[model samples]
Target: MKLLKLVPDHTNIDFVRLRGWAFGLTLLLSVLAVGVTFARGLNLGVDFVGGLMIEERFASPPDLTRVREVVDAQGLGEAQLQTFGDPRVLTIRLPTQDGADEGATNAAVKKVSAALTQAFPGATFTRYSTVSGKVSNELIRNGVLAVVLAILGIGLFAIFRFEWQFGVSTIVAIVHDLLMTLGFFALTQFDFDLNIVAAVLTIIGYSINDKIVIDDRIRENMRRYRKMDMREIINLSVNETLPRTVMTSVTILLALFALLFLGGHVLRGFTAAMILGIVVGTYSSIYVSSSLLISLGLRAEPGEKKPARVDLSNAERIAPRER
Candidate 1:
């Protein structure tokens, strides 16, 4: 039986030739992502912002405006209500209580539950959580630090393992992926919580893994084809690795898509981020990272003085002197 092949054998494509266009599009998207993030801001969850979050479900979809009014009538604090998953399900958040004491928090929850039940019969409280200002601040700081450290570490690894060019290109690609994810969250107002933080770190890992494979192949090709042009070497290397890259990406995407649709709303944001990362990572590995090597002045054989070729057939063989 013939095996399935996503990319055919002996495939040759000029991936390096389109680096200019890829770089342009990447820059435009990164800029737009940054601008959108600063302008619209991310919808942070209680993990980052100190608050009391309560999940409640009604027998039927209730008007959010009316529900907000009912919660506000209790005068607990400012209530923010958003649909969680189903229309009938909603997550209500309120500002941290004055003292943030357990009694006050529980009392507040009871009051809101009573008010909601009276306002909308059959409305049931699912769960509630609280985060203090200090803890939330710490969480935000740690999340940022984790992502930054991961990027720096991965860049350094690339530099040591391959070349400085690889490191720089890897960093650039990762930053692009991160900004794009943030922009998506900012635009969609998805809950940017700790789970999303984990996803971002995971993306960095996957991007680096993909990049390292192609970088290794490129380095190997550079050594084997010392006299070859840099662009030709890059194209050859990427084409050679295209099958593995495509196969790996496709399989991972299959799992992520399953999680996205069947894993419920809790994993929606995380799954979405992973899917985008896979696509963007694969793209950068092909177009941005590999091609950028040539532009970074990486020659087929850097700093290597071409050795003189000796004619062995015409030269007399020297015999060993008798000991």
Candidate 2:
């Protein structure tokens, strides 16, 4: 049986020629992402915003309006109700008071549970969680710090591993990926929690991994084809690795899609973020990172300081030959 080929051999795509348009679109999207994130803000979950969350299941899909009214009437803080994986399931959230003790928190949970059960017969309280404002604040700080540090650290590594051009391009692409992910959450009103933070970090890791592969190829080509134009070298490098890139991305997307559909609603947000990240990461790696190298003054020649290697394969041995 003949194996299928995703990308043909000797493929020569002019990725650099379209850099102008790619850069323009990248800028537009990045700006919109940042703007949307600021304008709408993230819908933080109990993990980030310090709140009480109760997961309840009903024998049948209860009226959401009535459910909200009951929770609101309890005089708990503003109630945020959202359907979980199933229509018959719901997650209700209410902001917790600062410095609320364990007793007070449990009492609040009991109050909501009691009211919800009384108002809707056969309502089952599956679980509940509480986060103090102080703890949530710390989590937010740590999450932001972790993401920023990861990006910066990766950029520095790229710089050291290859060149300054590689590092800068990597950073730009990663920032774009993160902003796009955040923007998506802001627009969709998806719950932003530690899970999404993990997704973002994973996206960064995947993006850098893909970028490093392409960068290594580009650098190799630059050294081997010293006289080739930078544009040609970039095109050659990306095309050479196109098959690996496509295969990896396609395989990952397949698994992610499966998890997206089969995974419970609890994982839906994380899976969705991951799916978007893979697509965006691939695009940025091919179009943004590789193409930006040329604009960053990365050339096949000039400023190359490595010592030339001398081949002695055909040279006579200085040592005496065996008689």
Candidate 3:
């Protein structure tokens, strides 16, 4: 189960104070990023923009300039050319006009195919898909709904599992991770699409798990160390769990890096998003979530009644005599 065997033991840094500084900076940066995303908007892929997607196979790899010339000869709005699975497979993306008729669209496709055939004899092309604007709109709406639902689900789960403070802190961390990821996409202008949505959702789940793990430890420490200060207890919990957090992140990063480099163009965007998410998720779990807990005035001392037990089965247990 231990993927990393050389992780350093607990450090005695003042995590609560460090958490505050980190969260404040992250919040300010996030607000600015969100503003930019709202103003500039995401660079949505062909999936969200009704377009003609053609996959062509050539005896020899097609020339990019020639492909562009052929598609432009068809008078399509604009054509994007990229290699797909291999050098021989070319992907052509063409955006349909705002009010073009089906006849116009088909004619454009025919013109491009004819020109490409004339230029590169023996090359074969296939119509991968032609999505409509209406479908793309529906997809955009559904993707937003899914993200909202995921956040709500996480909040509800946190409430049931721990307390309102834990729920609030965890939700804030999730939102932070999401906004930062979106900011990265907007700033870099990545081909944000359905696959990116899947990546974001995966990040949400992964980030929340990290927060929950830390919160679980904090809750346990709160019960055990009744006399400790809130800051001390939070710090203790974070320090104790830091090794596991780091190891998990490293393992996820390695897998994502492999996908980024070796998985080809189809998985490039997906893996890039995942890589960014893992880094942001880990950072927010440690700094943003923990800091938010303190900001919400969560105290280590139990209020009125004892809190519910948080399972510590995986954590190292110290015997009474050892303690």
Candidate 4:
């Protein structure tokens, strides 16, 4: 039986030739992401905005129209409602009340629960939780800090293992992936919650791994082919590794798409992040990483040492013949 190959080995595609175009595209996308994030801002979830969560199991799935009416009567702006694990179980995320006082949050919950009881007396509370403004703010701060630390940690590790240029290139590619992920959420007005942050961090890991694999191959090739030009070596390395990259990305995309389509609302944002991450991550690995490597003036790695510069004064001078 013949084995199938996504990209046959020894294919001589010139990935380096597209570096300029890729760099421009990445720059444009990054700029747009930053702009959107600042101007429109992320639709931060209750985890970062303080809200009440109520999960109740009804004797049967109550009339959603009636339930919506009852909740809206409380004037809580708009609450997010969806079925939990089972259809009989409903999960409701309440909007943050203007007042942060215990009384305000408590009263809001009381009003909501009372309405539920009147509408469906058999309804039983499965879970009730509250997130305060202070706690929410803290969570936001920590979430952001976590991303920054992750990036820094990954960068430092790459630099130590490979070279400074390789490390910097990886970092840049990861950042591009991150900004694109965030931009998608911002553009779609998706809930930017703890789950989404988790997904983004996961993407960082996935993207960096792909980039490192290619970078490692490049380094190895540098050692193997001492006379090869930088562009030629990069092109060779990427082409050689293309099969693995495609296989890994395709596998991940399949899983993520499954989660996106089959998983319920709870996993929607998380899955969306993963899907976008996989795509952007793969793109960065193929283009951004290598491009950044070249742009950083890394014609060679530290391990690929060259001959030391000759001392002109100590070097022998040749006599001119038959002037």
Candidate 5:
């Protein structure tokens, strides 16, 4: 099915003005989100802080408040309990006690395990574990490397397919999306973990595809509208591609919404990040990437002659000679 219909030929739309407003809004939101992140730190997940993760499955959905109280009662450092997978599944995260020996960590886990079993009888428990400090450091390093490599790869691809300017603008838009996603995590204090890193990478790949589509249209316009002004051509290109952008974004959002609401906790963080990225990525494609291209001196068409202004003074100056 055709998801988008082309605007009739000879239609006029003010792309520059539309892009300007979109860019302004993105800039405002990005700045505000950054400020919020800095003011209130992100809630780093177990992957960042050294800790233990426990997963338990009950015959029925366990009571979250009761589980939290039981775990807290054990004094096994600070623990967080939430449902995962099915409603019957529960995951607990707890910080390792300060200067605690191996025995202490084990003891804490055992105490919490015992308490959970008592609080919810006949529940089956499984302990899946990791060291928080190590996980956190590893995740941070890997995430940084992944983003850097993605940018570099995109830059090279852009340079190869189009121009350095295209590569640069594409990378900027990708970073824009990444930072915006991070800002969301920080603002909400959502658990930033390995899965989230995966989500960010997924977003980066997706956002770049959108950027490339718009960039391709701009390049095509350069060849087709040989006499148009740069601003006018860009506006035209954006308008031509606007329908596809909206359609793709909407379809992706629909899928993400389903995952966000129904995929359970195992997929919640991933879905949440994807949903946020979809919105930001769509805006960045039109506003951030395109505007950055204009800002970077993208020319409309090469060798197009400028029409000289009708100079009445020059005509007057030569009138006596002509007479």
Candidate 6:
């Protein structure tokens, strides 16, 4: 009758010692992700680049070329027809001119819709979404601001609750997780839509929460084990919290996996992002957050430091001893 041990209470893995390799690899991949982002850029979805999105369900798998034929006949301009999860569903995307007015774009979309209806009488549109060029630009700006402000907000909260080093380390690890997620998207050319932006923000929040959990444990250990080496203290705290981390991450991953498989293509990107965020977030909480302590000169004790006092009263009261 032995209980299962996810992480033994006395676990003594030298997590701090492996920081260099972990940090280096994460940094390398993050840098590469940025490089790729700048080079090829994200596969901008309609929300960011301005286009028409139509999700249609058919009696059966409609002919892709026939669908394209209808869109081209209507002169929708650069229409792409892709199959959604099952062959019974289709997603048609049409990119508009750079400065086309919204009404004009909508007219073109309507024409395509009409043509599609006539071409495949059995096809039915389940969703119709539109984004203007101006709106898309604004969305891009706002999305970036949201992510930055979220990080800044978390950093400020960490600073008020913990040391400045903890705040900085938390932000760094969060940025690492963000970069890794973005890198995965960039490399895979996944559709970077408003939904995905939401996912990234969610990831940031999730990642920071994980880091805070570990940081809380570290802060407690800093006071509890004041005489131990800082590295050892970090190792001890992480090991102590390892079980919680594993349990939380595994639970989150289970839900995300369920969504990834059962939620269909509509939620694929967002679910995949959550999946990636959890793993990187957990790693950063353990390695990146603790490693920064050494780099930022926060390895000292966490207790309050007393200011030096001159005791000027000793000179005035000089008769008691050899003074």
Deviation (Å) of 183 in candidate 3: 1.3
Off by over 4 Å in 4: 53-72, 75-110, 113-129, 301-323
How do the residues 141-185 of candidate 3 rate in per-residue lDDT, one tens digit apiece?
A: 999999999999999999899989888888888888899888888
* lDDT of model number 6: 0.79
Compose the digit string of candidate 1's lDDT tens values, residues 1-323: 99999877657777887999999999999999999999999999999999999888899999998998899998878898877557888889999987899998999999999989999999999889899999999999999999999999999999999889999999988998999999999988888999999999999899998889888878886787697677777777777778889999999999999999899777888999899999998998899888888888999777776445422221112211111
lDDT of 5 at 171: 82
Q: Cα RMSD for candidate 2?
A: 7.4
Candidate 4, residue 72: how far the Cα is off, in Å = 5.0
lDDT of 5: 0.75
**TM-score for all models, in order of appearance:** 0.90, 0.89, 0.80, 0.78, 0.78, 0.83
Minimal lDDT window, size 10, model 4: 314-323
RMSD of each: 7.8, 7.4, 5.6, 10.2, 9.5, 10.3
47 in model 5: Cα distance from truth in Å?
Answer: 1.6
Q: Pick the candidate with the highest lDDT.
A: 2
> What lDDT does candidate 4 reach at residue 109?
76
lDDT of 2 by residue, 1-323 (tens): 98887876556676888999999999999999999999999989998989898888888998999999999998888898988458988999988844588888888888988998999899988888889888999999999999999999999999999999999999999999999999999988888999999999999999999999999988887787686677777877777778889999999999999999999778999999999999999999999999998889998777764345423222123211212
Deviating ranges (above 4 Å) for candidate 3: 1-6, 55-67, 76-91, 96-114, 117-127, 302-323
- In order, the Cα lDDT scores of the candidates are 0.86, 0.87, 0.79, 0.80, 0.75, 0.79
- Compared with the true structure, model 5 gives a TM-score of 0.78
Model 5, C-alpha of 242: deviation from truth (Å): 2.8
In candidate 5, what are the lDDT values of residues 82-154, reduced to their tens digit?
Answer: 6644688888888866554677677776777778788888777666565657656887888789879988898
Model 6, 118-138: lDDT tens per residue? 878877767767787889999
Local error of candidate 3 at 28, Å?
2.8
